[model samples]
Structure formats: structure tokens, C-alpha cells
Target: MRAPCERSERHRSVARRRWISRASWACLMAACLGGAAPPFVSSVSFAQQPGARQAPPPAVVVEKIEVQQVSNPAQFTGRVEAIEAVDIRARVTGFLHSVDFKDGQAVKAGDTLFEIEPDQLNALVASARAQVARADATRISAERSLARNRDLLARRTVSQATVDEVQAAFDVASADVQVAQAALDTAELNLSYAHITAPISGSIGRATFTTGNLVGPDSGSLARIVSLDTVRVAFAVTEGLLVTIRQQQASGGGLDPNTLKLSLRLANGTDYGTPGRIEFIENEIDPQTGTVAARAVFPNPRHILLPGQFVTLYVQEKDAPSLPVVPQTAVLQDREGRFVYLLGKDNIVSQQRIHTGARVGNGWAVTKGLDGGEQVVVEGIQRLAQGMTVQPSQGQPVGGGT
Candidate 1:
């Protein structure tokens, strides 16, 4: 009975130990419920399914803004002309006469250009002179007869009627002499008109009337002569341009007549060596073309710039300080206005509005906005936006606008 009792005691003790062990296990599990995920599972799971890394925005090349001094030149187109030009014509009527000047020859004022046969003219002059001699002899005879009759009447040897008749004869002879003198003058004038002379000193054009071609007062133009030593160029300018010109002139910006420099480029691109000055400005504007005619005078010693030749003109305005310039690519235009992309201190791009002037070598002149040393975005401008970041690269110089 003692042994059985001891066995029952041992079983109870084991049962108690089992119950404590189960209670401790439950407490540990409850504590673990308040804790984070296990280290092994958390770390391993994250390593197997990590999220993708985002790519950085593409870097865009940019440029630095700068100020530069440049020349301001205005270009225009013009035409060449002759200083003076006139059509040659005969002043007297006659049979086909001799042309004294060769085609395209240079002639001086009063130079004989053509001549009519003088035989008929010379005969008229001789006949007029003979008439004058005969009239003078008749007048002398009438005067002697009138004196004899007067003496006879005074001596009562002749009647009063005879004396009156002698006086009338003398008067008629005097009238005849006066008419002969007038005829002689007319004949001399006709002789002079037979010779056609140049009215001006200039280059003569191709002769329209040949040596045997009839030339006279009614024969019309024989040829033309154009004076080219000093030539004039006529150009048309718009009303707006005229206003600008007037303002420039009023501002004391006009070139002196002696200092006015002008150059020409022909349609074929040949340069005219001679220089010129502005001569005249037309008062009226052409209603159809909406422009006024302006004239320029050029030194044409070589006569290379012929009249009526089309050409391009260049006029130099007042010299000014160099202007700020930028590449054309940097400039952008929209409904708002013209602007450029510039890199900021944060290495980001920002749009800046600007005023532009005439084109410089390969770029445009910045009239306003933007100081020196700012990075300007030239390339990749299309990809840039306001406040966008960019990578900048030094670019080629913006030379004169092409």
C-alpha cells in the first residue's frame, strides 16, 4: 500500500510540472504578439521583391548668357543711273545728209554730229548778196536823178511834176536795198542750221539715223547721249522708313555730303568700287508702290555702273557702341512675345523675355533684357521648360548674323 501511494504522488508531481510548462508557453506567445515581424522573414521577403529604382531626368545641354558689342549696319537695294541723258534730234529740214559722229562715240558740246549738203544754201547766199549789190547801184542812180531834177526845178528849167517823180524813184530804191539785206540774213541762218551739233558733252548712243538717212526738224530722234562722269541712283523707301530717316536726320545723325559713303552690288554680285552720296529725296510717294523715290550720286570715272542697271545698296549710319548678341537658336517666339531659355543658379532653366534688334553675324542683337554671364540654353531648347533643371555646355561663339 505504501508503494502504490508513492506512485500516485509522483504522477501528481509530473502533472503539476506539465501544467507550469504549458502556462509559461502561453505567456511567451502573448508577449510575442505585441512584437514586430520576425527578422529572417522580413529581411528575406524584402530582398526578393524590392521596388524598382526611378531613372533621373535626362540632362540637357545649355549655354551661358552674355553681353557683347557689335556693329549696327542697315542694308538696302538700289539702282544706277546717268547724271544727264538726252535724245539727239535734227533742227532743220533737208535731204539725207552725212552723219559726222560714229556710233557709241563720246561727243562734246557744240560738236558737229551731222551735216547737210551746202551747195543749195551757198547759192541762196550768193544770190542774196548780188541782189544787195544791184539795189545799191539803183539807189545811187536814183539819188543823182533826184538832185538834177531839184536843181532844174530851182532854175525853172523843169516842172514840179518831174521833181516829184524823181523823189518817188529814190524812195523805192532805198526800200529795195533794205529788203535785200533782210534776205541775206535769212540765207546765212539757213546755212548754219544745216549743221547738226551736240547739245551736251556725254557718251552718245547708237545712231538711229545712218549716214544716208534723212535727218531734219521733223526727222525726230537720231540718237541719245548720257553723261556718266557723275551718276545718280534712284531708290524707293517706305513711309515708315522715311519717318525713321527724318528722325535720324533731326537727331544730328546725318552724314556730311563729303563724308557720305555709299557702295553698290550688282545683281550678279559684282561690287562697284566708286562711292556715292544722297542727292535728292522725292516729295511725292508712289500710290501704287507706297514708297518715295530717293536719289544718290556716284563717281563714275570708269563708267562701269551703267544707267538702268539693277543693284543692291549699302548705307552707313551713325556709328554706335557694340551691342549684346546671342545665337538665333536661343530665341523663341510665341503669342506673348520673344524670349530665351536661361539657366538659373539652381542649375534649372527659366524663360526670360527680351527685346531683339537687327541681326548680327550669326545671331540676333539683344536690345534689352538679360545681363552678362547668365547661362543661356541654346541646344535642347525644345526639351526645356520653365524651372526645369539642365546640364550646361559652353557653346560656339555667336558671330555676326549670316
Candidate 2:
């Protein structure tokens, strides 16, 4: 190699000649194109470089906005309740002789739940019977005495006052007999109560009092039974929602609450397949809560729903407004709020700000921003930027409704 400075000078001279040639070529190209540089010359300077490759636009999957019929369901936390709930309490005082049913047992109306030992109750019944028999014996004797006394008076052998006195004695005995029979009837009724039976078909809870435990009417409750074949769900609605249920429509006083459709999501998040109908709405809102009570009846043949179970209740109105819907994948969110990339004319994508409402099936109900006919990018959004051009293809989102 020659001296270092001379070698560097020769290299600089060659680079300057190349630079001048490139500048002259760029000027000639600019002149040929109009009097200004090409559009990409400033922002994408490499486009003017010789042999540079152009990139293809990114591909994106898009879904068209669809008009979806929705029910606009109102959601609230609810509780599972039996239409008929009864606490099992012994009507007559006695020792619990036998627990007739197992804990958590399914029972029908008139099913024997427990048997209270009827030692004292039976004694009372026997005593009542004895008193009634004695009253009958006394009444018979008094009537015979009165008849003989009246016969003596008819023969003029006795005074009328004596016969009248005997008659009064007979009346007193008859009254005693009637009182005794009434007591016996009450005793029999009490005996029947000793055999505690379910008043309604339902699932029975655990037995509170076991064998040898003295239970009576005053005893809190021996157990509880709740009806299962047809259950009810109780939920509270806000003042606004209460109005919606009672007066959703202007005419006809409002939508009939009986016509409102109801459904439930259990605590475990599984949906109860059976639908329910609104059965009751309170006459007034609760003064303390400002919420009104409402109930829906559901057919629970399987007894899967239990009383006091917390659930998520959904009440749907039939005359819901049609809404613009889009697949969830098309939505993008940042600090500025939610937006979707709209596939506009000539494959250009622009950001569309949207006000989203409730989710409808697998998609979102678009409350605002988009009409029902526009297309939006649902996939390949990672590489997207504002005003970008993309290769758009249709995305698949199937059937709707829940």
C-alpha cells in the first residue's frame, strides 16, 4: 500500500465523483416527474435508492357490521327461593322418638318427616275419652231419673217442681257430655300433629332435633322443607329498572310483567337451561333500599336450584331496539377509549371511536359510532397503524343470541 494520507485522499476523490453522479441522476428524475421530488423522497428516502425493494401491504381480517336483534337484558344479583317454604316444627309437645327421614332428603307432601313419642299426648287422649264416657253415663242416669219423676207427676203422686228439678239435672249432664266430646276432638287433632309430616313436596334440610329430644310447638324448628318442582327466584331492581318493567311501553299501561323472559346463571357460572317467567312485582319500592322486589317462577324439575342460592339473574325485554354489532376481535382500546379499524374505500383503514354497550353472544353491541353496513378489521391488527392500507378479507362470526 502507498502512504496512508494519499490512500485516504484517493478514496475520498472516488466517493465525491459517485456522490455527484447520484445527485445529477436524482435531479434528472425529478425534472422528468414534474419540478418536485417524488412523494416518497422525503418520508421514505430509501425508495429513491437504487435496487431497493418495496414492501407489500399487510393482510387483515375484517368483519362487517351487522344489525342484530337483541333483548337488552337487565342483570341483577338474585337469590333462589322455593315458591313454598315451610319450617318443620312439632305441633304437640313430645319426645322425638324417630327421625323418619334422612338429612337432605327429598320428600313429598304428606311424607312423614319425624315421629314424636306420643306418651303424654296419648294419655291426654285417653283421659279425654274417659271423661266423655263418664259424662255419657251420668247423662243416661239423669235422663232415667227425670223420666220416672215426670211419670210420678203424671200419676199425681209427685209435685211438678220435683219433675222440673230432675229435668234440669238431665240438662246439666247433657251439657257436660258435649263439653267432654269437644275436648276429645281437640286431643285427636293434637295427636296427629305429633307425627310431623311435610306439608309440601320439597327437599328437606338437616334435622335440628334428634331422637330423645323434647320438641313442641314452641321449639324453633325441627327442620325446613322447600318446594322444588317449581321454584322462584327473587331479585331487587333499581327504581329505574322497576319503571322499565312496569312501563316499558307507553300504551297498555306498560309491558305485561308476566310476559317478561327471565334466565339465571348459577354461582358456579353455569347457565340454568330452563327459562323463567316474571310472576310478581312489588306494589311499591322498598323505602330503605329504593329498590323494588320482583320474582320469577322457573320449572326446576331436577331440583338443581336450591333456596337461598345466590345467582345472577337476567331479565330481558321483548321489544329491544336493533343494534349495530361487531365481533370482539375488531375492537381496540387505549387511554382514549375503545375504537375499531374501519376498512374504508380502496383498502384504507381508519380508526373509528365507538361507544360499546352490552356484549351480544360472541360479539359486542355497538351503541354508537358505526352504522350496520360498515366493515371493520378484526384480525391482523398488530401491524396496523392509522390510515394504513391493508389486504382485507372477511372474518367468520357465526350465529347470535344467548
- Which prediction has the highest lDDT against the true structure? 2
lDDT of each: 0.80, 0.87
Using TM-score as the measure, the top candidate is: 2
CA displacement after TM-score superposition, residue 159 of candidate 2 (Å): 3.4
Score candidate 2 by lDDT. Answer: 0.87
Worst 10 residues of 2 by lDDT: 35-44
| Residue 183's lDDT in candidate 2 | 99
**How do the predictions measure up, each by TM-score?**
0.62, 0.71
Give residue 284's error in model 1 in angstroms: 3.5
Q: 51-118 in candidate 1: lDDT tens per residue?
A: 54444544655655556665554467777788789887776666657887888898999998878777
Query: How do the residues 177-256 of candidate 2 rate in per-residue lDDT, one tens digit apiece?
Result: 99999999999889888888889888899999889988888989889998889988899989986677457565556766
Q: After superposition, how far is residue 129 of candidate 2 from its true place, in Å?
A: 2.3
Residue pairs with clashing backbones, model 2: none
Which parts of model 2 are misplaced by more than 4 Å? 1-60, 244-253, 318-324, 327-390, 396-402
